[model samples]
Target: MTRTPRGEAPDVGVPAHLAEHMTVAEQHDWIAGFLRRHPVSRRSALRRGSGVVAAMGLASAPWTLAACASAASAPVSVVGRHLSFGDDPLRSMAMAGELTAPPQGRVVVDLGQNGSFGATLPVEVRRLVSQVPQADGSIRASDQYFVHALATGLQPGQGYDYRFRLADGTTTDTATFHTAPRQPTSPWSFTAFADQGVDMVPPSGLSGFTNAYYKPDDTRRTMTPSTSMVDRIAATRPAFHLLAGDICYADPSGEGEPVKSTGTSKSPSGFDSFDPTVWTTYFGLIERSAASTPWMFATGNHDMEALYDDNTARGALHGYGGHAARLDLPRTGPSACPSVYSMRYGNVGVISVDANDLSMEIPTNAGYSGGSQVAWLRQTLLQWRAAGSGIDFVVAFFHHCAYATSSTHASDAGVRAAVAPLFDEFSVDLALQGHNHQYERSNPIRAGRSTTQVPDGGTARPETDGTTYVCVGSGGRPRYSWQPGEVDRYRGNPAPQGDVNVVSYQAVGASAKVPDAVDWSQARYLDYAYVTVDVVPPPGPGQVTTMTLRTITDTGVEIDRVTLERRAR
Candidate 1:
């Protein structure tokens, strides 16, 4: 309740005499405790990063001189720390976070066993933040110094505590995360969702119908239901999470081009509403989970960020330069596209596909890979399925639904044509998709045709029944209505009645939405939702392996449940 002292360095509620006597780690802890007592609005922090230091007369105050030193000379505090799975989920992992200021000394990441550091790895920091002062005198820090750290030589399927190590052995608070097991018999789980963004932060461009009507109160620890869902996911204790894309709607227009306007990012519009701070807010919000869990993200149309076209030569990067710096996705084929990659955890083989490369609906960044992604995908699947590969299930996730029934974006024939055939040929167990803002599942299909009706509770054998496609796009955005003449995912209390026909479409060259009739929509729910998959590895080879999937809503209801089973090799 106390205000910052005027014409003085912010005390951080600590006496300077005592702070100077305390250790650097203790000083950092004191600052963090100060933040807990006196909260700072995210908006003000983004706009006034340096205002506090300047207005507080830090340089004039000898008590604050050491803290006010440049980050290049001293270790700077960081925000939005997160992790991702590298090429090897067991032995290696990727760590990323952002810093407002530059770093001069090596930023070390300590992998802790018990309470002590077992291994220390240094990180590479890149200056990717560009500030464009708005007419309102507020700086739009769309980016900042991103710290990318990789840790290896870890024991498979083990839990380790990690923290950022600053100069003089000072460290951030520790968080625990688990790696994947190395054997097929190891059981594990994961969480998934898409289209989720920061809730109700209009300045960050997270205006869900202007008031975040989709958010519901769950735990009092967080303000947004998205964060609550993240906590719930962490409760499930997943080894890793799969975010199908549309990660953060920083550029809500999804048109690839986000231009500044007289009435800017605070309000939602067809165009001219781009605020880069939304990424900061979203990342800060997800730190609870992303800091401890590996959130593997795929590419979506909304993510085709064209906001950072700083260099015309690499304009094809499509704001992806920013993404690459923040989320170090593991890629095999090309550096040009960072979203396409493959990872393995125990008996499951996971892949992240960049649907932006194959989308016809949002074609701005389409074809950037020139068919290489598909080729690499084919090779990866083949290698995973080779004789004695030890892989039992292969799951692929991406944005741009290939078999959805939403009226907004029913199905991208381009996505279906490119990946569906490959998935079918390679016996992909599941294809998770997003960008539609609802949840819809499909029957097992092969060669673009539904093989048989696998009901909600039916067990699907992908090796024979075909691949099952699911659109868990209901991460945390506004709910979407089903296509006209089609029923909801399933019958509800009153039930959504229609002509009982699935009207679908494939976008054609940005000029039209080609229509067709289909009947693959299994269960539909127009609400904020997420998914959790419990992977049950086989006891031994030639045994039954199961993946029990539970589709849960924001209201804490299990609307649909399904199982994917196959024999272990």
Candidate 2:
């Protein structure tokens, strides 16, 4: 019958002094009876004595007190910051810590939005280190990571992981990466893809181009669906990833839309408005792997014209601008135009040109014609030759295809006419393109014309003089069909029948010629595969180099292999 303060029920076992005064009817009553008996003046003293008694009870009730304390002192953990390579080698790493070290290395974090919380977090560089190559001939350990900012240092070819500390004494982990195969002779591989964009609605009731490009559906009869090919590419773990073009369909509206001619068209159809956030999300998904590795991007027709329209109030779309300008890319040498640049690794020289600028009639009319780019290309190649750089191979990349058979876009005759001679003059090994959404490969041809044209337009015949043309635009956009029976199967056409194609082009030196009677019977088109190139140095103190292309599935399965060897005359 004992009563608690302001309550009806008390502990089952009560002290005799309190029990004697308890009553069920008194539950809601004030403590008038107790005050009267105790005298109000002495109440404070009485409460102090009761507190001592309660302390004794708490000591006896260990389980209950321990449970209360446990609930009150629970520990919580949160991740607060991250970092990535910015406009230059020096970039601040993102971080958050209540008590300790944040994770380190090259850290790619989720930086929510401009007005979003945690956007203004302080990012500082704690330290810098230089990694020297080791004795094993492997420079893997040569990679350096910025301590506070969580970025990797520039190395010949290496990858490194780093650690970061927070103010609260906590720590976080991150990693920075670089190209592999430090020595030119060591063999390394990489994947190539093109024409990926964010498409929410596609024609024919399809989800969009991204899903179709990946070939995620099993209902289709494609030789290799999207999942299979993506898996294959991932398994290979190529040192780097090459994106041909059409990265994001960011038009003035910031969505994938057909380009309209300014002269006649007042309003273009199928032009959808896009949210800038969507672009980042789409790229985040498309480049999940490449973000961890070095990715090289070349422009495509869609990507170049997709940014903004001068006539529109939207002005210029900055969706892809932030990423493109901030990525950590290898030096393509000093040039007036950084967009059009060249980078040499080992004995191979890669020249990335702005083909979109070359093909756009309006830009050319405005006196752009990518003339500066062309001059840069010519000068860079000539400089390499003059210095006796001994580059074993030369590969050029742009958005538009010099040769294409897809119904979507015609082969840019203008671009071919302008750049073909340059390729021939420099003895360029391969020209990688991706404007067309399908895959196509051409035989070695010195000029725009094919070396040996087949009567049926099936494939190219064997030839010893020409630059190889490869159209691998099917990165993750919608797929388009080639005209039936219009396959170009020259001696070098990799896949003459399927949607995927793979071929290898060799650089044998300036004096060597393309060998006649090359083999192409085993070539097959891949729906969603990647091409890997392995560069090997010549034996016995020779300068000759060899490159092998392996078309692999997303699971890292080698579907086809072609070898190109440089033979000096």
Candidate 3:
């Protein structure tokens, strides 16, 4: 079971006939062809081919009925439709402000202020186009819609009120955002989470794992879906929001099931094809928090859904074009994947990498970053640690966990073998990850193993300690159960198999090895939660900078909390 570029499990299971030498694209095509030639007929098989027509709202006319019937008889493209971020001018008219990197004179750059783009008065607003993949493997361009952003300039620790100008020249309600303090002495805070896109289907009465669609009522809301978990995060009013990936499950719908459309009537089955409007809905859900703070994103596997071609989506690593065009992110790393970049807020230097390039779990765009990215990461960390860099704490975040213990998705060996060593060498304070759908934290780890356990609410000095890796993937997705005997093992059980120190596999068959248990795993929780890191200043000069990290469930419960300190260089 080879991995994909996104560092998750391979999209499709192993084939009956091993095609070890085939490229991912070749394998993908071969599987599709095989499935077509030998179609698997099921109860809802009638709508398998023609679901796309009804999903696109083309089933309204009488003549379309004939077309739909004919389509239902043939093999239909099950790839779904999406709504445009700029579909409505009025909807797009809201602006969120973020501070620039250089501590400029009241300037607001893109997310994390990693780039330089001068802001002038009387900014011109124009319509933005969002691209969608069609059923026939073609690109469908949405109508252009515009949003006007007003930059009032900015000041350290200052709250600025702003409004968005609609395409028709109307203005949106005022929203306010606060800038981070200019110096490292000032304390700051931020939030991080991943995999919060809600795509549940209406339940069908059945039994077993394939029985019912897991659609919760809140997931189907028109606005501010509960699954978004943005409301609670907004209440904290963090300096920015770090989305590690799978922000929207806009990929194929039904979670590894065939596309089935119930009828042209009411709501489609919970297991319907993809819906592009999920993007529109997702943005609305996250608006409150994002509009108030910088919302930085790292592309996950789901974000790389280039239905027509790899580059169709936006951001680095063959990401979604629409997702990239919608946000104002820093363009510092390789131009091919702008999502990989660095930023500084107070004493924290945040570096985001594109794991899709090296991920064997999602091979759609494997080798996209090549070796240049890891080289860049090494250099970025070295620069931050240098004198006069003003970065006291180095935090790196991306999709795919380097060290995690969830039964649903284990640690990505590629990430651990390639990236973890660099992080340890650079004395990175914290490594944040998602895609496991659970919350797990590791002790300060060096050389692929933990030297000692960092207790909950404990403080670790990075200068002498290794890097701490945390998986905060429970941002509103269904929780993944832990490995067997995880509870007893995490509670200091000494048995080998029952120990929680291992990053087990979801891979099938033999030839898999159970490496020595990872003594670094200190905490594990199976709940829907997010992490908030508060950067606190040291009490004296030459002292360490401290960061308080807390994992809070959606219900406001603090599940796990820890503090990390980085001594002055």
Candidate 4:
């Protein structure tokens, strides 16, 4: 609540005179503390990177000053700082993010071994154009580009020092990253969630929808210091972060606009549509964690830009113009379905499938790549199961739920009809889903029956048979409820639900009903939570691998835990 004298740089949240005498590290820490305590509107000191870089003495080198200066007008809103090596077969990474203009010059990637630069990779840059409908019925156009530096041949389980070199021969600060392990000899964990909002400060006169479920009181209590779920995830320090979808909710209305009731269906309040600012806010929110971790993505329904109802008008685009521009998903799946891809880390093989291709809920891409995606899925699973495949478990994650019972957007019948059989046939160890806005897991199910009942904090051997389906949609969005009072995991008996879990009918009542005593429901929680899966490898290869799935609250509370064991066939 005080103003610094004009013409002199503000002390970056420290006493002005003391800041002048502080070390680079001290200044960096001071700036970080300032950002944490004060509103971002006071970030003019760090806005263009000049003041902050100077404050840290990082711009002392002439080349460094040149590189930082280029970004001043580069329109680089936020760097998609994370990698997705876990989702790419070659373990190559596409370092991409949203930008307002096409980037110039090549980027030099220095992969350091130990403390020295082991290899330098130079890649060309390219751009993807996006045209989105704005709130005022105008088109907001922008270009996003990848660094073109595809980092390959990285040794798994090895940590490397890396940095970037701009076109002007300027090098950036060194950052450290660890590659996913090819074989885990011990327990390894990764964080996962969906529906995380950017927490944007809306434009003047525009506000977000009031979330009825994740009330202000609950958010006030659970939100961390940065007021971000990413902060909590970073605290766990998982190998990677799996974003199940709806990364920013940069839709027409955003997170604050209330849903507009329109007949049987409802839409968001039309305040803004695909404004790049949403992504700007999103990248800033996760920069703390994503900059180092491989934050992989699975396309959710909201990620697409589908404003029209006519299916034919949408064409084969599937509403990923903006997404394709900003993010670089693996192109290993069917050419028609860029969202479908697979990768492996340790003994675990993960397949990110796009349900929009066959989704009855959002039919923009219905049947476009249905056959191809299925064929790819079968082949991918078969390859992972082949002799010497090294893969002990296969995890398939997508947006829609195949066996969720949340009060909103229950298990999609279309998903079950198309994808469920393949899961059983391939003996997938796990199926992760979102869109339900709650946390729920099913028993080890095969052919609509429970193959094994896994209690809370229990373990199951999915490698021998059956698959466990889990929903980790409660990342940061409003929580959904369960229809019944209490759906027991072991038995079909109805009991009173606990305080953490709520009961609501407006969302999943009619669609979530299961025939016969549906005892397949396992652990269920209705809160803003995420799932951390720990994949534990055996002492040696060709042995049993275990995956412990823990559903944790944003505030770091472990509510439910399930361990799954699998072995390579």
Winning model by TM-score: 1
Off by over 4 Å in 1: 1-75, 131-143, 168-170, 184-186, 202-223, 252-271, 309-316, 491-501
Q: Report RMSD for candidate 2.
A: 25.2
**TM-score of candidate 3 to 2 decimals:** 0.72
Candidate 1 lDDT at 180 equals 76
Model 2 agreement with the true structure over 249-365: per-residue lDDT tens digits: 533222323222121112245422222222322433443354345566665544432112111221122112222322333335333333455666566667777664465211211
Q: What is the lDDT of residue 358 in candidate 4?
A: 55
Better of 1 and 2 by TM-score: 1
Per-candidate Cα lDDT values, in order, are 0.67, 0.41, 0.55, 0.58
What tens-digit string does per-residue lDDT give for candidate 1 at 423-542?
Answer: 888899988999888888888888766787776677888899889899989887666667655665543426643432476777654445788676666677776678889899888878
Model 3 CA deviation exceeding 4 Å by range = 1-156, 199-228, 252-254, 258-272, 308-317, 488-500, 503-516
- Candidate 3 per-residue C-alpha lDDT over 428-505 given as tens digits, one digit per residue, 9 for 90 to 100: 889899988777888888887786767777788777788889887877665667776575222222434243366465
Query: Considering TM-score, which of the candidate structures 2 and 4 is the better prediction for this target?
Result: 4
Candidate 2: list runs displaced more than 4 Å. Answer: 1-153, 162-173, 179-182, 198-231, 250-271, 286-288, 305-338, 360-370, 452-464, 487-526, 553-560, 567-569
lDDT of 4 by residue, 93-137 (tens): 544433222344556777776779978887555443323222222
Best by lDDT: 1
Residue pairs whose backbone atoms clash in candidate 4: 208-256, 208-257, 209-256, 209-257, 209-258, 407-507, 407-508
Model 1 collision count? 2
